[model samples]
Target: MAEAVRHVQVIAAQCTAMGPLSQLEKAARELHDALTDPMLGGCQARTGEYPSLLIGDDLTPQDIDKAVDAVVRQAKADGAVLVLALLGHGFTPPQRTDLYFMVRNSTTQSLRSAVDVGRLITEAADEPGIDGVIAIVDTCHAAGGVPDAGRLAGGVRAGRSRLAILTAAAADQPARDMCLSLSLARTLKDGVPGAGPALYIDRTLAETLRDQVSGQVIGRAEYDQDPFPLEGLWLARNPSNIANAHADVVGPLGLQDLSQSVDMWRGPRRSPGRLTRSTLLELEKFISCGRVDDELDSASRAWVDDVVTALLEVFRTKEFLADVLAGSLTSDLLRSAGRLAGFPSRAEGTVPLRDLLEYAVLRAQPLDGAPWKGLARFVAALLHEAGISHVDPRLQEWARRLHLVTEVNDAFGEFAEARQRRALRLVVSLVGAWTEWPEEVDAWLLHGSADLPLHQRFPCEPGGAHGVAQAIGAAMMWARRELPHPELLEHVDIAAPAHLLARWYPEEEKVGRYLLGAKYSVIPRWSGRLDEAEDNAEINDAARKALKKMSSCAAAPVEWIDSDALLDRSALEYRLSTGQYDAAIGVDHSPDDLEEVLELLLPFAPIVLWPRSGTRPDQDQLRGLVQERWHELPDGLAAAYRHRWGAHQHCVACLGDIRTVWHDEGWLEFCRPFEYRVVTTPEEEA
Candidate 1:
């Protein structure tokens, strides 16, 4: 295991814009040197990365954004003690809601033109995975950056932000030039006089920095709300000979100031790392894409409590895991964790539990659909056999996050990811009457969730049976250029409003002309749902239900709404939205009558299929085919068509109106803003 790095990152920013303020520059430089001192906890700013913000006449929000993002990201760790020392003037905008680090070009109206310290410091202070913060703000209204008490520890359990904030003055007052920064530097460089062996932030250091400040100083820490108070932070070593004499003796090795001597003994430093909530969330979404889950519904939050509990158990006894999970595959899987990603250094043997957990999460988290032959595969297999296969892929992610499992199972995971034929999503959206050629609408052939969609605009003459087919043909031709194996596409999911669904679309590929309708298994979804906010509770719940119901494909069919039941739209909406229904079949409704079909069913029912406008095939055969090929979904829809298209009467029912929807709400979530789960690979520090 790597030695813990107490001060993981040191960032000191000053906004002396037009011309440099010599005193602020000197203080910020001194603070950086003090924090990076080997004796004052090991933080080495040797990555050629600047330790201070480079503000000037040319400064822009973009520059500040990159600098702040890089620094805070580097400090992501459960053991990290981040030292944020700012020497700028803190200016709260008119509303006094957002505090900005004022520069020569800064203003209140356009926040983008200024460095909003609230966005920069206040928010970053409470982010998960940061163990502690020692913020020394030396600007006017410095107290503005201090978050409300207990706010840091409120949202999460184990990854709580416990920190001591020391500011130059009260929220309404002005600050003395560089007083707080200089005081912290001096206190750290020269140990606290007559203090304990290790300096703690809240009690000792806060008082020291406060006394050194010219005027009143404000300090805040969240210890009152912390369930298990963090261990005393070794921020600085105490050199007081008198204080040491009365202290419980350890040995002569406890040095007051090892400024010049410590480097001679300690080996080269390797940075300590912990998975942040954002990175873990991204990994969860990446794995859960195109997958279904159940609704015990812990999906909304990270399972920090679980991993912490497991780590505690591992600490009690190495063999305790085996005893707890006697017959299960969990113990057998964890036995392989020693060989997993290095929680610092890789090896196979007895190791500390904390390192083991970190390694388990770090190694197993694949940011893309790329094949990762790691512990996730085995854990996923174990979960599948427990009677809930693919029921909430997050379960596999969270459980393994709590820690590990055995060797590669390429058969299941590899084929699903690598050899797996990716989807070619075709979307049709109504433009409304405001645009020219009202029938001239938008269509997209999506390559992947992250890839830019290929778009084309064309008018589909209403009731023009060939209009939808011609549009599909054009998209197919364009899509084939991109696919390495053009022949490998299983089927296409057409997402459209009811008018478009009312028409029949034929598939005319180079292979031959065959009615594509034989293949579609409509899964309802609306493009507008993508516009809804992430915090939309109603949509989020409905989407989760849709994702959860995907597994019901294998279970016996529960209920399907028919034409008579679908007539009363309100009644149908209530039944479907509140309860889980597998499919919605409309046998007699015309395209005009079905205008509101998607709006009502979308995001609720996983599958919705209505046959061609004219034909009403035998209901028994249609239901049987749906039940038989339910699990594979849109892909399976094609297989059912190929097996029964035309030769049997059920073929018309299966293929004629099958160009339906498979509106995987999870797909929408990932594509629109995957937000945290962007395609960018995480810069995880090992």
Candidate 2:
């Protein structure tokens, strides 16, 4: 006995309450074309009041119901898989939660006259012998209409038949005009050509339709029963399916197809269009399941090459890189690729390591390169882990062209000033390969010399000046042991002094004096001159010891200057009284000396001192002096003196007092008379 062939039947209907001007008619035409297309193997009977199942303008509620009934009856008789596509305007009545599909004669006031979706599904479900049902709804708030339809259909089916529902939007979302319909039409057109034998809507096709309609109109699919039975049950043979069956033999050609599809739909910006979690999961599974063994045939080789090419394309995109950093789809793909690359334990794969290194090098090729530092850091670490003795040509070129050592020095300088510290950190991580590249290490030492304050010139591990100092010390140690270049070692030695100078001379300098004064001060206890021979011997011995220690580390020869003049109380007093402030303010005096000088000078001229260190004279003594002599000075001179040093009130008062004294006494009154008259020039004297 021969069995009868069961077929698939498609019934498409559109509501046109807005008449000929309505877009529902156009949506209806598109749905009808998609259904009856040869690829779908849909049966269209011409027995109804309308020639075909497409219900549009002039169709009343009664006519729609009759048409729907006839289509269902024919499909039931043939035991066919039935597909229902509804495109129309939908209505929600005031104070009502339910939605309705409006018929041509239906009015806003008489929504009950419209087709209730729940009732329509119940009618379809009552019919016997229908294999399965796929209802695609394109009306506004179509998802809101689905629960009722599913519930009503469940009662009629009594668990005997299968039902699947696809809606254009969620329950609360609206379906925009033409967007849902156009996407649906396009999805159906594309999906039907890939339907294998049995010709019924499957999960793949349903998901494909959902992906296609996203952003334009968000759609969802639900099934009343297991969906596995419906897969590949369509009547038409899909050529693409035949190709996919031999996917392993074709190698990675499917990836190329996927890449092309992504490019086509990704729009002008090449954005990550509608790449959903499901799509990524499917791709990952495909790659994982189709992975070949170590031995490669021509086809497998091609497959591996294409896979790498596709990944490179993905890595180049900003959107994809963001996903990679976020540990999203790209991360997953890389992990799977990594497993295939022979590292199954790592989450991020190593297959793309070489490609990423090359990409980073290319980006860093220009003089002012904009390399992705994070990627570069990863590549450097990976190479270091592999114990590579020599640098890759691409990496070497990047280092050579960009002068990465100089970049690190610049970043370190900015970091010392509390600016962009991350730049320094990134550069440090990227130069992990410097040990393998001797030229780069030498370059770093040479470039580091140009910046003053050693802390600002060397890479530190986030600690600060001390951290930088330690890093430089460690580098020096390494260079002495590992580096053979004499010049490089010399450069390192020179760098050590900059660090020492920074530590010792940390204060700001004005002229030859330090703002914070010298770190060590000499306290003179003797007021009288010592024996010349003993003093000279002692000073020379001390100078030699200091010079010996300094010469070893200093960049140039160290020299000590000698002076014959002795520092005594009388000379100090004379300099202070005469307003020779530089000599009076000792080279290494603390701020207290400035005060003592001002106190001594109060009895002499109205002196305003500008010392090398910019330290002001003692405030209290100056004020007391000014107060004591306030009544003796003219008002104009006192006011001028006060105004001149008013910023430091004590200095102003001292100036006022001194002006009173100087005005009353002559400028030379404090100078001593010459006691010794020269008799050597007796002839001139006579």
Candidate 3:
């Protein structure tokens, strides 16, 4: 039996009286043209070649209903997919909030006379023979009744039927004239080739349209049933004969050919002949003359593919590879090849071998015998040899593909275990150089816990901390090396301490106690003692003189806490309880007591707490303390106190200037007075 033909009905119910809705008529015409065009395989209408029954302003309410009903009946009888496109002005009547599509004679007050879009869609879904329905509404507030329409459409659970509803705007947003219709018509006309042979337009195309139009004109689509059956349903073949003719270019040339050619040029390690300068110059000339065809015909596109393949063959030569690696004239040829292969092509005076290798790995087609693995390995070796410590996204991708860390470890198999650890350290250091902390470190730290005292485990020289105090000491050393200015020490929040502590002591309570001790005890107490020493006239004079002699030296003076002072349990308790860090430090304390105090405090001292200056002990006393201990105090604490005090003073002076602007603009309900709260610190309670 011969199947009946499908039908498409486009109804443009434009209200001519509404000034803004004139574009709806044009949109309807464009949609009709797009649907009926032979390029898109739209059904030819019975009356003529055009494939739409457009219901324009001339159609009355009864005429529109009859026209729509007739189309639905015909579509059902034919067992065809019904495409319904509506372009008009929509309105929510004041008597009721439900939205309606205004017919030619319909008024805002008489919305009942207008088309009930939901009821119409429900009728279409009720038809048993109609397998699919595509309903598009291009009007202001088109989505207002979509939810109800969707529910009604799902009422009839007939055989293998699906309903797709597309709205020009979201329920809350207004639809602009011509925007949705034009974009959709364009997409349907041209078709998205990359999405395969499916006539089914997905959300990706909607997103593309949204990006092209104003944000307010965004469109939405909903399906009442599974859309899988629509996949690979062809609405139109490629209109461009040129694209059709050259579709097989990439397949025939094959990525394997390029990979094999490159391998031949690389040659065996024993074969030592290098590429000549003249050959490189000839390659460069060829690239300069090799132009990409803009016409996009089969012949032009095929020419481009051939030129790229030929360039790849030239790059395979060992001499050319050496010249490129050595920053010789062949670098231009490499850059040109990258451009031809559709990689980022920018002219470079000198191209690094690593970049060329990365480009090859990125552009190589996914095929058997492609040199992606070899190229990745070559790039990794170059990076290692060049001592390049920074990590890039491309390098990260290569690392994943090549299993970089594992390969690096395997390469050092001939060396001792200690040497292998050292080699891993280089890789870790490079990773750390780019990121503040790399996740790779967590695995390495866990696996190599026995070898904890290596340089890789600590941030400072002769690295490795035996305990909390040694870790704090290592952090301080790192601060001195990295931060030349004494003021910068306060800003240095040592992340390594917390990270190491978490791994070393996974228990929550133990980690908390250690962090608290480090935060309160070690930093503030040691900082206070340093302040007291700096205030001494004789020591200050001597330190200033010593500093002048070696102005460029990276090293800073170290203040060693006595072991007895650090170990004093009573003193540590007092400091923690009263927050009086200075009371715990003294020359009278023995080395053992100092060590105990340090052991107690090292865990908490990593995080420094700055006191609120506005509500602290007397303002005059605080200022005096700051001036005396400015250099010894951490930069973060100092800056916080300074900014707080300054802000408080500013607020007090500016209170009179606070005026409510909207109160004078006739918004009487919004004229409300507000008050500010005073900030207080813990020291104020003490």
Every model's TM-score: 0.35, 0.32, 0.33
Model 2 residue 171 CA deviation (Å) reads 2.6
Question: What's the true lDDT of residue 194 in model 3?
Answer: 62
Question: Which residue pairs show backbone clashes in model 1?
Answer: 293-392, 333-405, 517-655, 518-655, 522-660, 522-661, 523-661, 523-662
CA lDDT, every prediction? 0.46, 0.38, 0.41
Model 3: per-residue Cα lDDT over 501-609, one tens digit each: 2222111112223432222211121221111122323322333333332221111111112333335567645544442321111111123232333334433222221
Task: Report the number of clashing residue pairs per model.
Answer: 8, 11, 32
Model 1: how far is 379 from its true place, Å? 37
lDDT of 2 by residue, 152-197 (tens): 4456555455566667676556676645667656655554454532
Off by over 4 Å in 1: 1-3, 7-19, 49-58, 77-79, 95-98, 108-110, 149-159, 216-230, 241-686
Ranking by lDDT: 1, 3, 2
All candidates: CA RMSD in angstroms? 21.6, 35.7, 28.3
